[model samples]
Target: MKKLMLAAAALALTAGMGLAQDTVRMGTEGAYPPYNFINDQTGEVDGFERELGDELCKRAELTCTWVKNDWDSIIPNLVSSNYDTIMAGMNINEERKKVIQFTQPYTPGLPSAYAALAADADIKGGVVAAQTSTIQASHVAESGATLMEFATPDETVAAVRNGEADAVFADKDYLKPLVEQSNGELVWVDGFDTVKLGEGIGMGLRQSDNELKEKFDAAITAMKEDGSLNEMLKKWFGEDSQLFE
Candidate 1:
């Protein structure tokens, strides 16, 4: 459960305000496709998080706007008030809760997986790449493997494809699609271990923003009880995805 830390984790310390918040800023790493990415046609952020964040804002009576941030500085900028909430595909976990509060999860969960050029690449005790400050990177460090950190998820995948890394570890939702699209260039390593966590993904906010958290938490509860969240989960993450809440 990442709730990703930026490279400036030691420097990052960060909140939300609730007041029918006029144009609440939704911060995201727009390079992560499907979860969040800049739409080439409009040159604006678009993806599951974009759609989900907008709806959550509506239900919470807050007006929302998108703010794109680099993954490395994402948390620092949030602490600096560059945005009101982090809607990046961040997982809910203890490591990040110390600095930022989170609403109840919106998506059920996502699995962390490994991808490499070979179908049988050895993930254990082998070089693996992951986005810097992510859970996958931390997992790699603790596992009997060599960890290489990259500034972006794309670079991690590229590292494996170009022989800089033996394999790349990232969210399965993200890597699975890439493996499918890669033809035979890449594949998920058989028997590769994954980072284990039961937590779902949540929206990051300031720890002091209790009211804001309550507002979003209630909105999420409504979506789950009515099954709309699950419907969207299937649309973006496939029918097997667990329901939100």
Candidate 2:
């Protein structure tokens, strides 16, 4: 009996140590602007997701580390345990939910807009160009436009500007800057549909990690109630932002 009690105590001690050493590793694309972009000079991660990660760590009482991963590889890396969570501005959709768990949405999913360069004199109305395999691509395909698919957002934008494609559909947030930069070259068509866009973005975790998901969900709720989440959004997206308002 004495030996058995000693063994149990030793096992408990080891379990506690293992729990204490656990660190939450978060992954992001580190390319999307105002969401999870990396600082060009410091190579340090910075953006809304970084700030949100810090807030999540404070709430969960866990040490947090950020890992940079390419957008295309993020889901695979998460499944492989290359990271524990994903904070990139990834939309939570039924398709994605089939593989991973997502916390409560932090931002409201807004519709993407279709824009075309004014220089494209041959193009008549709103047509379609999009990054391949993206939600926007599907939207374009459904609209009956010959889908001009590209590898990246930059390429899609260039396609429209260079008249290779009539228009490009992208998230309103990303499209805003491009339209502004076009200096009157690109214009948003007023009637582009947004019904197919998925739900808002959220943190992605392994499907089996319910404990971490609960903790993160609770933290997000607390932040929303206390105004910290709104403050963070304002800091990055500007005051009068509509995301959480």
Candidate 3:
């Protein structure tokens, strides 16, 4: 009877391993642009992260699919096995590292900036809008500013435009295009230094998936070495954006 029980456990383990390799579902928030977003024309996930994820999967020789998830529940869903990996523009920080393991950073450290209608808008101690559950939101919450958290990144900017918040704090890359398109209506808050919040953006995986993480890390390394990753960064972000050496 003990031998039979051992056999059953081994079978279950083998099956689980096979399932994991069959198809890797990459979870992402389809709201963050240049990182990840839904293409209105294609109605599909399309962005820098999406392109990077596809290449990573190809190099790893893993069958992969994309899954759209809300930002607030992304980590929880990953933990619950709703997806196998997270390719969202998640940063590698000690706080998040406690919950999930991260691959080598795919992108260099990115700065977060504050944007408002006026260049000198109050950002240090005024109401600041940020996407909920993001590092920018946490920064505002601890920086003595009243944080106005919204579910979507768009809504955070909307809050500032509508005068509900004094400024909106977010990734500089995400804000750059918006600021340009605003045509003087929106601008970076002058004198407010941009803050480098996290280590860098990386893929988030389950702690137990060490092998999977290694596969992706290797692929990312290859991309960096070939300079393809830098090119992608330039394509998504501007040429002035940071890049790996």
Indicate which candidate wins on lDDT.
3
Worst 10 residues of 2 by lDDT: 118-127
Arranged by lDDT with the best first, the candidates are 3, 1, 2
- State each model's CA lDDT, in order: 0.84, 0.79, 0.92
Which digits, one per residue and each the tens of the lDDT, describe model 1 over residues 1-245? 23355534533432123233556888999988789999999999998998888888899888888999999888888888889899988888888887788888887666788889986887787899999978788888988999999999999999998899999999888887898899889887887634555377899998777877898899989988998888888888887765654
Off by over 4 Å in 1: 1-20, 193-195
Candidate 2: clashing pairs of residues = none
Per-residue lDDT tens digits for candidate 2, residues 62-174, read: 88888988766788899999999999878888878998999998876756777776433332344567876566787677766788887667788888877788777777777
Candidate topping TM-score = 3
Error of 2 at 145 (Å): 2.2
TM-score of each: 0.88, 0.83, 0.92
Candidate 1, poorest ten consecutive residues by summed lDDT? 10-19
